[model samples]
Target: MDNGIGNWPTIHRVRHPDRIALIDAANGAELTFGQLDARTNALADALARKGIAQGDRVALVTLNSPQMLEVVLAVAKLGGVAVPINCRLQAPEVQYILGDCGARIVFSSPQTAPVVAAAVEGTDVSEIIEIPSGEQRAAGEASQSPYETLIAAGSTERVEADVAADDLAMLMYTSGTTGFPKGAMLTHANHHWNAINNLTAVEGIGPLDISLAAAPLFHIGALGIFSLPLLYVGGTTVVLEAFTPDAWLDAVATHRVSVAFAVPAMWAAIDATPAMGTTDLSSLRYGLCGGAPCPVVLIESLTRRGIRFAEGFGLTETAPIACVLDIEDTVRFAGSVGKPALHVDMMVADPQGEEVSRGEIGELLVRGPNVFIGYWNKPDATAEALRGGWFYTGDLATCDDDGYYRIVDRKKDMIVSGGENVYASEVEQVMHRHPAVGEVAVIGIPDEKWGESVTAVVAVKPGADVAEAELITWTREQIAHFKSPRAVYFVDALPRTATGKILKRDLRKRWSADGSAVQR
Candidate 1:
């Protein structure tokens, strides 16, 4: 009976029993509110039977699916922390997260089963529940149970736990700009309030509205902002396993999806699709683009088709959304991320944390009920980031006289490549492992497809010769492919300061001055 996310399905089920709540676009599968409530309850009982009690960690490693949402809700119902892993991560990266969180159970799919199996080898993960992907399990692999089997064995009786509002709900991992990824601890209240803020910002979101889940559910932006908010208001959410322009357009047309959330890169691909002009997107009232800045031309093109493309800014530490540019202001303030959400307070401050003058670029600070508590198991990082009750987002932005904010640069050495955050330090670490590399500096350069592409400027050791493509391949083998440098540039020596610190600004200038970066 607490005001947690676990109660949302029950509330909606009682209010609108037969109303459609979710639609899996991949196979035209639908789950009504009544069915959703019953299934989540059953899954909660199943998790409890598996000894997943309160405060336990339950990790999910799968693509977008109705079962993914069900698992998250089930974990919440049992007062267990839900940790959704990025499906795109390599085995080692997944292993680090699984080990760090000490997950008791991991729900994986056929696609990610091999990676999960390899990751949980020495970890604390005791159960691996595989969600069916239309593939038969190998003869020898009977240790893992199918997702459907667990649900079938569970009872529909409501299984409840003593969950408090301030209890931890989600442990979201963010790829840090420096060092390994950290899990941001988001409480039940944090996610609940975020959904409230989202409902207030986007108009006409109710049971009648149909939303498209195009963004990856593992990301806070997709789950916290897009799916959770819609589910809270009893709206229908259409889940897409993965994003493809043609598939996205087809879903919007088939489901008559009213709203959606996607990155600017996705919008560009949709616009560039050959069937875009012929597709009927009139059902879409508006869509949100974040993770990177939206091109003015892309906004104008979508506007011409009666689809308003709004933009937002936030981080995983702030439950993903802090500010949003409304649909009406899409053209008026083409580049701004717009004003803060209803219950959120934002400020532009200097390095000393004092407020900056209007129109001056400074670090963006946000404070609200939606802001997460801190990073899991990182007290020092939590203290450094959450100072004076405000989350210091290491992003440089300027606010206009009218209070619209425009992001100018990232204070952190991070690159937004195709909607994924690639930390320069993480990429540099991989490059350093290469035997032929002596010194390496990674920086983000302006790119057309991705907002910014990861480029590595390397200085090979004496008597060591390494090809650009070979170095790129080497880096990809060590980390996530998306984090690997798309282009490599060899230099005699990298520009450095007297303190022996590489000046990344100089590298960016040098790379731009001479257009000689070897493209992948």
Candidate 2:
């Protein structure tokens, strides 16, 4: 009888319809549980009338807004797959996803309508509905709205679709450093359990916690980490239009944001913000970092300010919350992602799927209700990854004697030089120690003698500088000399995905095409 997450707001409305469910941080608009349920129902009916049926793909190309979440739930209500495209991606990139998914209907916001309009030109998208925005957005560009205009036109009755737990809910594409994006098919069950896993894994989150959605909502981290968990518990979510160091700090202080999640880069920006020291972060109970290896220094910095900062390891395939460092052990076990999350079965295993010895690095494997079903339309890839009912996360990690796990490096990101294996993350972690480094990504350059040479591409902080030789020597002192960067390249900024992950493949291709980009 349960219709998965589509009916969550409906259930919560019965308990506390007046409780605030969502907030638009940029415009100060709010939605209560009752309002959210009615709106999602109405939107679902509107979408159904537009011919969106079970198994149909509905693509959403927009920024973080309450309307975006509304669309997500509305599509789920119809048993339609919601495909979220990164708004930061260019037209061709957006076109690739739309063409690949063959989305029937496309949703766009004023800020991203131009890109969507250009991208959907040759796709199967029959209708492109634009959500209205304030006049301040997109440099005062005008936008036509038919989506919001139709929200009140449909009936509020629950439109039944027989939507099941096993039915596909979302087709979240993986934004990797290499290759084309692959859609990870997540079921309603995956989302339902991700929320349960989060509620059980993190100790303090409850009905009153207000989580800040700063990271790109298209990514699983910002959605599955806390936002949906809060939604499940009748809590509030304040959606940010876009992320900035000052905007994030101000939102936390103004909205009294209690729980949040960010990538290492965002955390560094917050640390760099001058107001970080003066900001009142008293309302925060805890925060989480993911998408990359979180530097231990960031954790220590926040904990010293009486804010609980924890790091975890997860992927888009796991509905993203596979494990987390407990609040009590955050400082004591600074580097490890800690034990597997509740409801998740984790192991470090060999290529044959056999469990490896503790302290030995191997592929981290996960199996849980939260894990995604498989990659959409890629049965071969799915079979390879989902062998034996366990998703083989290509992350190399080790389980310590105390049952904690630490990710060493991604399988594809590892570098081999002079027959020695080098993890870019390890080198990058030590590189982050430099006072002048703002962001950095380590890669391997082709080398005849060593097969590949370790290299670092760095972006120095504003008003800060570091010499190439000085940084190489600084890295050599902290780690093995061979693992240190043989070449250093400085740029104004490191290229990143919408989720704040440095695009190492793009960097590799850029330097390969232009030799002058390398300093050493």
Candidate 3:
């Protein structure tokens, strides 16, 4: 019943104080609700003293950790926007985001310093808070103590912010498949309602459940689906810096992770790990799979292992939780993404924005409180995306007679990274810039894990020879690291039709045949 720009910190503090809140499953560091709330308050005060006020955007460049969660909560408490930057992005790409979002403060690990430094070189960012690398002597000493220590040493004057339900809460950048990255403006209400709906839809996952945050915290799947919902119900979240088959299994077994969510790529890797077969996975009771299609084989494998796997579908614009398949639907619908959330309205639409009938593949359009406000500062694009009170998701999906939906393919060339969208055209443009490149097309190839890996096919100019490594290095310099092609192949001529259009479907078929091209 609570509305009006839900107070995130209040939600945690008032419900359960002594309950375990978050754990760095990698290092075994744990914090209760009261302790986590206190840490976030200190961070909020620090950001306020540094002049980050209401509506200002703050960039978080750390990996999965409790500190990452602290800054996100602090930003929300102060009515500022939290911009979760992809840590995999290189310097120039990171710079583009810093400038694009006009963030005032950036928190990054040593691994991201060079990239953060390059991005903030000409910007107005006042502070660059470093997360201890445990490698650099000076940085290590500086970050040795807890972040709460630094906050307590500073003044504690509370900075009150005037936040409205419509104000932006988070700015999630879409992977630039076609062009420059666009930051989707998700409101606090969008996230709050999405979490409530997801918690209800998932069944039996409430206040006492423990969830895994193994995916990149920068992704909505990790942040929204798992982390936010756990925080909402005053449950526990276990953070893992990165996923390894052994590490993920260890975390699940040791931590007793009851509700776990992972992208298909993570599942495939864990499934393939020899150690996975021997691990005790009985503690895992619920599994949520998204970021790409959940293969029937993977679902069956998890089910056989005593884990219930359900399919989910969403985009950054919907606060990323639009539809979920319940446990009953998982068996009935099988591969379907299930039904829309109770408060959400979903339907397929054509190019003209008219609703299409069942069994037809059209762009999925959603309308609800969970829908985002718009893209930051991009009025024309926002107008096009949100029309007639619906957020237009450029994803192709079909609904069966039973109201279950299944995503066929993205109408836009979007590639999901651990549950984040990466547009193909955006990366292809960067690859085409190379002097030796004559023509290029980027497509997603099937990976046993990662669901789809970014792959590029290039038609080099005659008499110009470019090695795979050279193209990889050149392209990585241009875009975010994840957006770069995982593998590159050069051909005398690209497969095309008689009219001269590149045949992407054929290209994907050829590339996925063996998966042994030059991988960057």
Best by lDDT: 2
Q: Tell how far residue 337 is off in model 3, in angstroms.
A: 1.4
Ranking by TM-score: 2, 1, 3
Q: What TM-score would each prediction reach against the true structure?
A: 0.80, 0.96, 0.78
lDDT per residue, candidate 2, 287-323, as tens digits?
A: 8889888877777787787778877788999988999
| Shift of residue 289 alpha carbon in model 1, Å | 0.6
Worst 10 residues of 2 by lDDT: 135-144
| lDDT to native, each model | 0.83, 0.87, 0.77
lDDT tens string, model 3, 286-321?
A: 888876556565676667766777778887788788
Question: What are the per-model C-alpha RMSD values against the true structure?
Answer: 10.6, 2.2, 11.0
lDDT of 1 by residue, 316-366 (tens): 888878999998998898778899999999999999999999999788899
**TM-score of model 3 (CA atoms):** 0.78
Q: What is the lDDT of candidate 3?
A: 0.77
Query: Local error of candidate 1 at 112, Å?
Result: 0.5
The prediction achieving the highest TM-score against the true structure is 2
Comparing 1 and 3 on lDDT, the stronger one: 1
If the candidates were sorted by their lDDT against the true structure, best first, what order would they fall in?
2, 1, 3
